[model samples]
Target chain A: MVPPDERSRALVSVLGTAETKVTFEDPRSIPEMVLAVVEAALEDAALGWHDIDAVVTASVDLFDGLTASSIAVTEVVGAVMKPETRIAADGLAAAVHAVHQIMAGAYRRILVVAHGKASMAPYWDLTAWAMDPIFLQPLGVNFLTFAGLQAAMLARHDPHAVSRWATTAALRRSAATGGIAGPISVDRVMASPVVASPLRAGMCAPVGDGACAVILGDPNIGDRNLGEEDVRIAGIGHDVGPHHLMIGELTDWAGLRRASQRAYTLAGVTKPTFAIVEPSCLFPHEEELFVEAVGIGTTAPHSPGGGLFAGTAPVISGLSRLLRVVRALKGRTGERGLAHGTWGPAGQGQVVVVAETP
Target chain B: MILESTIRLPFSYAAGTVGSRFLIALREDQKILGARCTSCSTVTAPPRPFCSSCSRTVTELVEVGPDGTLEAWTNQPGNGVFGLILLDGADTPIVHRILGTINPGTVNAEAINMTPGARVTAMFAKDRTGRITDIEGFIVEQDDP
Candidate 1:
């Protein structure tokens, strides 16, 4: 546990995973998936539900096809009769909000949870609703089309962008071990059937259902329940770009750059460098944008565990990346890492987190 | 047992003053309207009530274009071609369906005459409903000999 004097604010730790298919025969319900992750998080933190003072959850009402989707997980998250806030975007954004609560001295320990089940509804079809109803939606411009437009623009900007993206997709998939979808070669990626023009089937992250839970607390509480190793959430930042695609630059993730700058400033990172970086890159081209926006060298260790290409749940992808970094830095000393998450068309919303082994 | 049920959610969206006027223009005059931000001088098609850049409430509605240039485009499998068109007078491009046949599936440089910088003009539907779809789609403007 953290000492009383150092009880200002910190993400005590995190835990979770993503699966393309939860079960072979029967698919797990939303609450069931959320419960499993919550229980595992408590186990990892060695804390009980009673110890959690507040809860922050990430879920989209349209994705669940139910209003107040957070209510579905309230009982499982132990948020009944307690303060619970829901973030309708990526899970990492929810985690960032929970950090604010701890820092404000509103809660001693906060539980952050996120879940997404793509099997319930047609994922891309639901994404269309997120578009401007009057203008873009009527034209049938969904997430895939927006991605196609961006990829096409990138290709147009750089003649070799298509081949480069194919290489990146192949590398990421090949690095994935025990993923639901197996690896592919550059040739195979380039030859794969086109879903959206330049974006091949192999270049897109396989969508799936998943749930993640992370527990954050003051340093004093963390130090009390001392474990073999400890990782602290040093800083967190998130930004929302223009909702309309016409308003912002399609190729550059300016929002991510702003978010990362805020996070780096808070973490006292003068030079942006990390031992490992896990980016929620849903598309191969997005990984390229992420690297450029975050100011990380091309050779920097990125998504060693294959990232979203391996198979990522929609809202849960970002939080899962955080979980990966936390777990990776747990035993190591003097190691720092970064995890990035994005939402909306062409990554309009971005969240970044900086962490270190203490 | 697999239980199946269809959920239909009924919603009523208030288009507000700006949207209502824009729709009226499209339906009555077959004219495209855009909202001009006085602060930033940026015009957005399918006119909105507010400007995104300068955070100013825009009340001036301007007639933009019957013709526009295609900035980017894609072919949606079953759906016909669609492209982002920067209408003649608007600062931003509006995404709309492209009528006429060139290619059917996949977004390629050669498909549906969908290269960047292509010229197109609005083709209004015969039956107007004061909705965005009333302007059925955009047709590629042919070059004169």
Candidate 2:
């Protein structure tokens, strides 16, 4: 894992990024969603489907309720005859895998699209089914339960934790102008119905339907419209934590911390600072955990524009975080940033990407 | 109109050699089994053939607790309380339901202690089946709080 820096000149660039506004429920189907983002991303990159050498998609069979979930978007993603790889986890993971293709000198351009419709079914039940059917599943518990467990553990020590988490949720929701999750005052948040003990509905990111698409291209070889402030992926890192919540450290995102260390190593920088940082924190407490894990002091413009509290699709949350970082860095060029993504109960899985202006 | 349909696929999972023995011990003798990894010296309840930490095979099955300490627990609405119990002689905690009069109607706070490090014992179901549920749930043998 070498940083795509001086040692490796064949680095991957974010040619384009586009995503539909995360909503309570998208009226369009998966294919239509793919088509919309594909067109917008292609337009942004100044390229067409023919320019993309391969397609890497992020979707899950269980999430889509369709076997081989990628089949639905095959035509729209322009993967008719080209090579395609599907990642069943977070959307950012798909981009991480696609970067490998470019770094290996295989593909010049790869289109990464991740879509999810949380409105399709009861999302928590699906996550519960993802657990070990032997022990955890029969208990009828899901990710929310784990979050509650973790929160209770955290709050047990810190008397002010629940109130602080409520304030964090209210602040994020108020900043979340995307309209996916309506804003609520701190008092209202405190009064919000509990989804699980300690974790109220107001504290959770209102998951809904949305899709995110990004175009990753070999910066060295392509009719690349080399923009001066273009933000390219300098380093990529991902780690899978132990599946059992009991076995792993629950209070902090140890997996994300490890992934960031790997990324910082690959980026060739030991002590790093960023102008922007985006974390795929589905819950408010997670934002605090991610901030502490990465050691990025909470003062930076972290998760500008409300982060996941603005509303985001599950599988695409991490990739969506990357999109936010890319979009943010585009305006304020020549600055470093990090994007984080996590999956499974209590952040048992994590991925991080370090991006910077070239 | 939104299309709504349920996708159902009935399936059965074969708990491999280690898991089978662990379940069988509970069914036949009311004994709890755990595997100690030779390489890592880590004990895993609801034993797996392979150690999750070191990826090395743990074939030595040892009789583990009918008692353990509650590492953590949560009260999931609509679902009863669940806890991660670190059985005596095991490093990893096993997640299971908390048994006792926990039904909301009779949920005696004093009877059901949810604090971490609370001592509990495995209670076997009278009607034993070869499943994790064979042990109805862990009872509060000694409430820490």
Candidate 3:
């Protein structure tokens, strides 16, 4: 449903999701992981390295513990002589940026690569550095503690909040395929040791190392013979809330609501209806916020692929959700699907992408 | 095979004009300063250079309360109690540790007597550096009859 002028700029289509593995231990270097995903992506797209016009990557220098971390993967992504952009945030944001470049007629084909390895160092320790040094850093607050704060606030509002979170965690983990975490029960979830009060260890997503790459191209530049399995990016939108957690309402995700509204408007979807929805919810409470912000009623099918609850790399979680949605649409699981990604403390950054079968 | 190595990277961080001023206030006068945005009439604690809500430069500096209300709190496993405190004159809350001998990690509501909306007063450390840790933490303020 992209407008006429925009449609000609580039008909952005997702070629495929490539080589994503969730594991606590990946015996591969950062560049090796990048190469693996890039190779897999090219093979799935039925194209060679020469076909890619530009590259966009997502990785945090802090997480990688290197300066200009993207430099390590540039050669593998086939960006030695081409234009490459790096997003220090989540991978879904990088993909959305790639969509803009194609729509602006900058390039016909753009390859998006995102990678994260939680095994590199203390993940939470690095995250603490992202906080306001003067105020937050001294308190030793990290993403997990922030999540705990949000969960406690939500618990104050709803009496059965902890129980609901436990159930959601159990269901998502059970539905996960190729997940590092096995199926867990609600009782086990409740009995699990508390990471943050009101949020048990079982309710948190398993963080691991993984990489994902997707090749997108203008429909005209690619093969003329189109197939029913191809999926097109119908709409995309992203938003960043205040950097400080105290600035916004802790209970609701206003940023996601804004992002999803923009995407829905571009996709010309007046109703909150979808065949499938995949949200990068690192915690069960976050899934509740996503559903409320996106205005998807309780009946809508959500995260059939298990979402982040299964096991997701920190920075790669969002883009991986997109991969799941694309695969679902291609497999005839849904005609229209929604994928959501988030970053920063307490969902400060949000992105929504709407994909539909061609 | 499993391989492990430690890599240490050294770097220095600069706290700009706004941050420097906040630190100076704490070091010299033991005062908490916040910036007030005239456009939005919002006061942000620890003073940011710009008003996030209005997207305008905030030049007016105001001294907020040594007393505040706890908005939310959590007890870290090894660490002590931490809470988001809404200072008396500021619109935004500041995250800090709660100072007390009683550990909220193991105590219940009745034992700790700390909950959301509880009144607390800032307690400064004896050895003050121009850092955020100058104010050690907040303690429960007893009500006067």
| Per-model root-mean-square deviation over C-alphas | 3.9, 3.0, 3.3
Which has the greatest TM-score? Answer: 2
Whole-model lDDT per candidate: 0.79, 0.82, 0.82
Task: List candidate 3 segments past 4 Å from native.
Answer: A1-11, A331-334, B1-3, B7-10, B101-111, B142-145
Q: Backbone collision count in every prediction?
A: 8, 0, 0
> Which ten contiguous residues of candidate 1 chain B have the minimum total lDDT?
B102-111
lDDT for residue B22 in candidate 3, whole number 0-100: 87
DockQ (Cα-based) per candidate? 0.51, 0.54, 0.56
lDDT for B20 (candidate 3): 81
TM, chain A, every candidate: 0.93, 0.95, 0.94
Candidate 1 scores a chain A TM-score of 0.93
lDDT string for model 1 (A72-138, tens) is 8989889998999988999999989988888787988888889898877778878988888766776
Candidate number of the best DockQ: 3
Interface RMSD of each: 1.9, 1.9, 1.8
Clashing pairs in 1: A1-A222, A1-A223, A1-A224, A1-A225, A2-A219, A2-A220, A2-A222, A2-A223
Per-residue lDDT tens digits of candidate 2, residues A203-222?
Answer: 88889999999999887874
User: Candidate 3 - CAPRI tier?
Assistant: medium
